[model samples]
Target: MLQRCKTLIVAIIALIFSQQALADTAWDSYKSRFLMPDGRIVDTGNKSVSHTEGQGFAMMMAVANDDRASFEKMWNWTRKTLQNPENGLFYWRYNPVEAQPITDKNNATDGDTFIAWALLKAGNKWQNPDYLKESDAIAKALVAHNVVRFAGLQVMLPGAKGFNLNSYVNLNPSYFIFPAWQDFADRSHLTVWRDLINDGQKLLGKMHFGNPQLPSDWVSLYSDGRTVPAKQWPARFSYDAIRVPLYVYWFNHNSPELQAYKTWWGRYPRDKTPAWVNVTTGDTASYMMDGGLLAVRDLVLQPANVAAPQITAQEDYYSASLKMLVALAAR
Candidate 1:
């Protein structure tokens, strides 16, 4: 009896260690695959280019995994390479192949939010005042530059430049970044962030307007009190819009705004759900939904007890990142 008990304990210990190993391996593999030595994160799906969004995602993930070294590396790279020191905002994109790596200096609001949120979290986790100060500065800059009162509610522009077209301003609903907004609201004591959240939820509720009734990737907020899909962008619920539900679910799983996504997605069989939908043309994507998207679908639709799917080597940067995020939220 004693010998048998000893063997069982050994087996249990091995299993626990194995499980921990697997968790570490997943994060380690993600860092190795997508994160460069210099801390830039490559968007594998987007021609291996680096973007502020990617860097922010990486920094957030690093914090989630409690990898302070990785977080610092990513932050350092971002500060050195992408930050417009004059304004404390980051440039949206960097193409290593180009003679001028940063061809555009526009600040993507969503990217700024993500980075600020990550910095705040890292500061709290590591007790670093510098990170917190930087985050606060970025938050203030966002409020000063990217946000505007349109149609009687505060709304975040997708970027600092080119979004305002005379009487109308272009917006991406997915860029709302609900959790980050909430954090900013609390940290900055700015009612605008709270107002933005409320307005964002209202915008999200109304943007779903098609046969299937889903939010478009881009929308226009007009001066004369109208909101519709942007004329310049395709009227589709594609890559950008897919993130809406994920953010909503993360911030508030019981949110009524999330129900629209759940209901619309429920119409299609899980395996047959397309990667995107053209709300204007009523056309679906040719390809099936990827693992990351499917993981998000399951997360939003299923009960919390159901375990999130594991990340695999086959997945790309975006998909793998989504899977990791879902796993983090699940915890």
Candidate 2:
């Protein structure tokens, strides 16, 4: 009996240590592969360019891993490099090779939300008022510049500029980062965030297209109350839209909104999952869905055994980020 008890204790201790190692490895691998020593996070798939989205993702991941040093480094870089002095919003992208790196000063609302959300989480975790203050500033900026009333509902613009075409406003349903909006609503004491959340869900429900009925990366909301896939962009459920279900599941695993995505994705065998789908044409990319996307799919659909796939060295910045996010969500 004594020997059996000792063996059981050893096994438990090993399991705990193994779990800790796995957690550490995920963030470490991400930093080594994607994050530069000076703090910029490279989107390896996007010509190694750095974007506000990647920076926000890094900050959030760093905070999740409880790596204060990395979090501060990334935040400082963002404030120095991306933050627009005229407005608190961050620039959408930075091309390092250019003499003027910040050519496009417009802000991506999703990126802004991610940065604000990270700051808020960091503030709460570290008990730092400064982080909270910065987060509030970003949240206010988003409200001032990005939120708009369309078709009798408040919605987030994909960017601070260029989205409002003459007859309609273009919206990206994935830009509605549900968890971030919820946090901002609670912390900033702003009812707009709550209203945005409700309107966002309504918009998402109406945005579904194609045979499987999934939202596209881009959609148009017209003054006449029509919603359709944006003609300017590909009418497909691809990279950007893949994040919809992930965010929804993160905010509320039991969300009714996730059912359509779950049902659509369930039609394919796990190994045969397509990288993307052209909703209108009934066409799909030849490549299979990467492990990272598959990891998120599993989390959203099969929550009980939420096992994030192991992060491999070959995975690029986005995939690695997804894997880390899954690991964080699982915890």
Model number with the top lDDT: 2
Off by over 4 Å in 1: 1-21, 303-309
Error of 1 at 263 (Å): 1.4
In order of appearance, the predictions have TM-scores of 0.92, 0.95
Task: State in Å the error of residue 38, model 2.
Answer: 1.0
Q: What TM-score does prediction 2 earn?
A: 0.95
| Shift in Å, residue 23, candidate 1 | 3.3
State the displacement of the C-alpha of residue 24, model 1, in Å, after optimal TM-score superposition.
2.3
Question: Residue by residue across 232-267, what tens digits does model 2's lDDT show?
Answer: 999999888988888888888888988888888899
Report lDDT (CA) for all predictions.
0.86, 0.87
Tens digits of lDDT, candidate 1, 218-252: 99988876778898989999888888888888788
